[model samples]
Target: MVRFLWVCIVVAFCFSKWVDGFVQYSQRGDPKTEIINNTLMVSITLIRGAEAKGAVCLDGTLPAYYFNRGHGSGANSWVVHFQGGGWCSNITECVARTKTQFGSSRYMLPETGFTGILSFKAEENPDFFNWNRVLIPSCDGASYSGDSENKEAQLHFRGQRMWLTFMEELMSLGMRHAKRALISGCSAGGLTSILHCDKFRGLFKKSTKVKCLSDAGFFPDEVDISGEPTFRNFFSGVVSLQGVKKNLPRFCTRHLDPTSCFFPQNLISGIKTPLFILNSAYDIYQFYAILVPASTDPNGLWDNCKLNLTNCSPSQLQIMKGYRNQMLNLLKPISKSKQNGMSVTSCYAHCQAQYQVMWHADNSTLIGTKTISQSVGDWYFDRAEIKVYDEGCHYLVPQ
Candidate 1:
């Protein structure tokens, strides 16, 4: 126990240093921009009448999106992507969030680089390169599904309203006449894509081809290393504090609790729209935050392993394999669907579709011969039935 306590102290100090370095790095502009100069930067566009429509962010600031218009053969095609950041479960966390880009548009960068699936370059994003792309920021703290407000805290949980306002605004801007459309996101934004997939399809005419893609958003309701419901409890808090119950899918809320419905595992099967799921079998975020949180690993036994999968002990690797199997089992039902597509790789990373190397680089991560971009594109265009899974663990350092 004493050794464990010592490890904890060491880990804590290292974490503090990392956070400090991150702050300094952020001030210099997005680190990715430095590495990839060819990225296309798109400016933010705040909704004109969002405040009047009660479609404001957590701090009541106007909600916004970044858009890049399409051309030629893709002029009528649209890609709506949601920006992901972690959520705030309680009033204290929510209040803290209002000061950051996640909860308020005020802190967001005036312009952000669009890479990965949002990239406009044909070589980088072959299938959707020329398609009109829209990126909606997740600034309301509830995956764009909450609808209640806390007057005392001066918080506005109007994500649902904000989503509707975005749709209405985009329709007026040209989406209504789209020949094809796709809704996609990563992490929390990925959950938003799933939550609103059917609704997005309903917005277009029956002839318009529409589908949804969720990247690194399949958070399971499993117990942590300590056999405690850590993530479940956190999700429960978010649901209660944000009044998310009323907005959950009726089919799910009718049987399970609101917290359960928030999990993609319970909600994906019920989605009527064609959906594609892209996730890392050993998602790094889930490995640290959900499977073995700091509270669960007080001794810091997982400190090294969490940071680098290659550092894991044989026993730890076995445990991760079990977790991977669990995720695969949950995904079995969806894999059987001819209309749905999946790309579950054994990479120890999170949110792949948004990064250039992971999406379509020469050495990009792949299952069989298809890169992530190819898999998604093939599924989107019905070129093949993609239900590929990686059997061997590939501990590639996250980019």
Candidate 2:
């Protein structure tokens, strides 16, 4: 227990931001990719309770952010992106993460290139390039929800505090006067976006247009192929160990378990703010962590299948198809929601918008012939009624 608590403190201390931890594509910021360099990284100036509450990373560093000022008519618009990486459920993983870019700011680059939703070039990011943009690094092992504070344990699970401090700083930088605002994140960051969507909307006046977008964040709470609830168990551990119950949405806690509220399926229905869900029905992360976790496949029965979808046997493919169906089943409620819009495709990948090719390129994956960027732009501006886009694997762009 002592070692685990120490690991937790180290993880929090060394925490840094990641662009998109699970991106499969590379060569970002190239002309072909259309992800240009536009934003500059800036370390946070004021950290509320940093000294007393220990809201510091493993290296005793503060959170770093990348911000770009808007110009022309976009001067009043703001978009904040929360960086994403997977979460650490145990001490070993958390301790190890603090040493890598995902957990420790010490190893992070002083500057990071902004692509996808953060793209500043009008040609590439057609709709939102000029909006005042901020990219927040998430080093908290708890998806910015943990609040456990035990000095004897030598742990500081203050993800909730960190988020509040970061938001306060951004608001001071001019988010409070924004005409329009959008909060988005990918993977674990995607989950954070969902959890904080309503709170973000409340930050501004009702007259201000506020919404949320989540990329590859709609993680389901279904049993894996092995008939085990791997993700649920993992979330239970996160909630219990980090004391995440206090940070969960009150509406959800009134009826459901705190860990259950962490999942988007249960959380979204309760959010008052409008939201857009951009995810793959066959999310690659779910394939690895939820569907066939290492704990369930201890003998490595799913080794090849997890690495390469093409290597799966006929029966395994059938199982994957069922999993996709389950995702659609889970999404049925949100599809009917008037306040929510979705672009869930059947691609066997995760975090598509982080790459320029998938965001708005000629060869970008399409949902009803519209690229992810086009769809999100149209939805954000209320250009048209955005509905859920799910055409199955046949419509998936060749990865």
lDDT of candidates 1 onward, in order: 0.88, 0.76
TM-score of candidate 2 to 2 decimals: 0.85
Model 1 residue 323 lDDT score: 93
Residues 53-166 of candidate 2: C-alpha lDDT, one tens digit per residue: 556553345655667667667778999998888776766666676777666666666656777787776777898877877777777678888876445434456678778877
lDDT (10s digit) by residue, model 1, range 1-399: 999999999999999977754422222222222223666777788888889989899999999988777766888999999988978899999999999999999999888888899887789999998888888888988899999999999999999999999999889778999999999999999999999999999999999999999999899999998899999999998899888899899999999989999999999889999999999989988998888989988888988888788888999999998999999999987798999999998887889888898888888867878899999999999999999988644545553
Worst 10 residues of 1 by lDDT: 26-35
Specify the highest-lDDT model's number.
1
Superposed by TM-score, candidate 1 places the C-alpha of residue 358 at a distance from the truth, in angstroms, of 0.4
Which residue pairs show backbone clashes in model 1? none
**Residue 238's C-alpha lDDT in candidate 2?**
76
Give lDDT for model 2. Answer: 0.76
TM-score of each candidate structure, all chains considered together: 0.90, 0.85
